[model samples]
Target: MPKPTVKVWMEEGVHSAIFAQQAVVGVFKLPQVTCLCCAIGLPPVHPNVHSTQKGRLLMSSITSTQVVSLSSQAPRPLPFWRRWLRKIEWRLLLLPVIGLLLWQGWVLLAESGYYADFIVPHPDTVWARLQERWADGSLVTHIATTLREALSGLFIASLIATALGYIIARVKIFDYLLTPYLIFLQAIPIIAISPLIIIWFGSGLASKVVIAAMITWFPMMIATIVGIRNVSTNLREMMRANAATHWQIFRHLEIPSAMPELLGGLKIAVTLSVVGAAVGEFVSAREGLGYLVMYGRGISDTPTVVLAVLMLTVVSLVLYSLVAMLETSLLSWRKAGKP
Candidate 1:
């Protein structure tokens, strides 16, 4: 009997090799090589592959393995739920762990009198400020105020942008008419024009909402326009052939088709809306995280400033995550369509 020839293939991103045993028939007249493969979500199977025949080589048979679960032994896979949780845990911890270590290092240096507390600010100082603000009920007020402004602006901007984008995309005359004005608006930086907006809108909730809307509208509008334009011509023609009304066509075909681009724009717009709200607050506001940051800066309170900025970041992340969750929920159909 001849010795068995071993063949191995590497799996990408997985630290495992697929090993196959190839037995050659010489004196005894054995048939072919037996290869064991671990199938996804299924039990392993042994396949007999022959390389010699009357004139050609071919696959002979696939059978059950008497033993050897390569998956269980070599590359162990967790249950889907466990894998999901582990992934989330890893992603969530990786950043904060690194950040806390760096921050603590800085804190240690600052506490040792090498760096001034005013400049670096101990992590404890920031935590103390957070607790102080929370105890006084002021933290909730600022957070709520900011959320109201950002969400309001985001909603208003999304509505106007989505509506106008459709018109600009579908109607040539509207596109022509809107182009020059859109160009003018695009040329003017929102920050540069923000003071004017504050002046015009008179420094209230309305002004903040307007500023946020102004800042947020462009990206979503562009996305909607692109999404609408990118809709398949065949789908449009099919709808027309079926005598579908414009409303029906838009609701059924266009909405689903354009969802991906719209969601992408929305994710960006959500973050920008928070910035816009903060910008509005910076220009003029009685209360907000931005106001807290400004107030801290004026008084040289590094801890307060850091705390406010952290809260603002948390707000942005929360809003961004909500949009992401919504996108995932709504876009499952897209995944279903994949072959």
Candidate 2:
């Protein structure tokens, strides 16, 4: 069999035309033919070339070439607005939009004297109060105080929980010993013990930090325990077969397996830490958003109270979002596994 020859005559306005013919003819093996006009740089014979055998072959080859060219070109990009819409997490906006609409309806009802301002203040009044606090710098100071306490408590809690969780998960005796105490601690309401904690540590930063840490600790401990224990048995056996040390097995096998769960626990702890800090402040504090809330309520300043609550909500959301973003960056493998 004779191999088809692909000859190119480099000329203006004809490179694509000849390349297409050569490619299709070689691929489909339709016939051993040449385009004399294309190879020698003459004008196209005819747009419709079905009049003769050679004309039909030339036309088909050119048609196939055009098809290949169209398929190979990069697709046109979407318009900016369409691209932006696709990028948005639209489902996540639903709850907030609904809440906003409900709030507006309540404000409308309040304007009709359905509820007193001191009871359920208008959204505009709350916004004005937020703006006033922001202008005086008190809002920023209160938010900083709360965030400092919350983050400090979370850091300490995470360290302790991780250590305790690992020890309990690895040793059956430790697990048996600690299980009852953990349950007891979780069952007892933090509100019930706040006074005692305030008494022991005083109505200062120490007590608040301890309170926040206590509130954030249990869930993280449980998550870590579950994650470590749930690591694949096959992986552990393989590590053992390789004579891996306890530290090696834990570092290489357990920690990676447990990362997804650990991050999940961290996200929960981040939100709870905000609540813990607020609770601690509520029990005893002269400053912080919780204190602001208490002061506003004592004076019947409903707008101020509303503003403080909104600030706490914002803080919680920001912290949770940070944890979620960190989880995405670190546990990208989990996302990769998804369809």
Q: For residues 74-112, could you state the per-residue lDDT of candidate 1 as single tens digits?
A: 554578899788667567668889998988787787688
Clash-forming residue pairs, model 1:
none
lDDT of 1 at 30: 24
Q: Candidate 1, after superposition: displacement of residue 309 in Å? A: 0.7
* Alpha-carbon runs more than 4 Å astray in model 1: 1-90, 112-114, 337-339
Error of 1 at 244 (Å): 1.3
Instruction: Provide the lowest-lDDT 10-residue window in model 1.
Output: 26-35
Runs off by more than 4 Å, candidate 2? 1-85, 92-100
Residue-level lDDT of model 2, residues 8-98, one tens digit each, is: 2323333332333433332322232343343233444435322232423334344332321112123445678998999899788898999
**Alpha-carbon shift of residue 331 in model 2 (angstroms):** 1.9
- After TM-score superposition, what is the CA distance of residue 64 in candidate 2 from its true location, in Å? 36
RMSD in order of candidates: 12.8, 12.6
**Among all windows of ten consecutive residues in candidate 2, which has the lowest summed lDDT?**
64-73
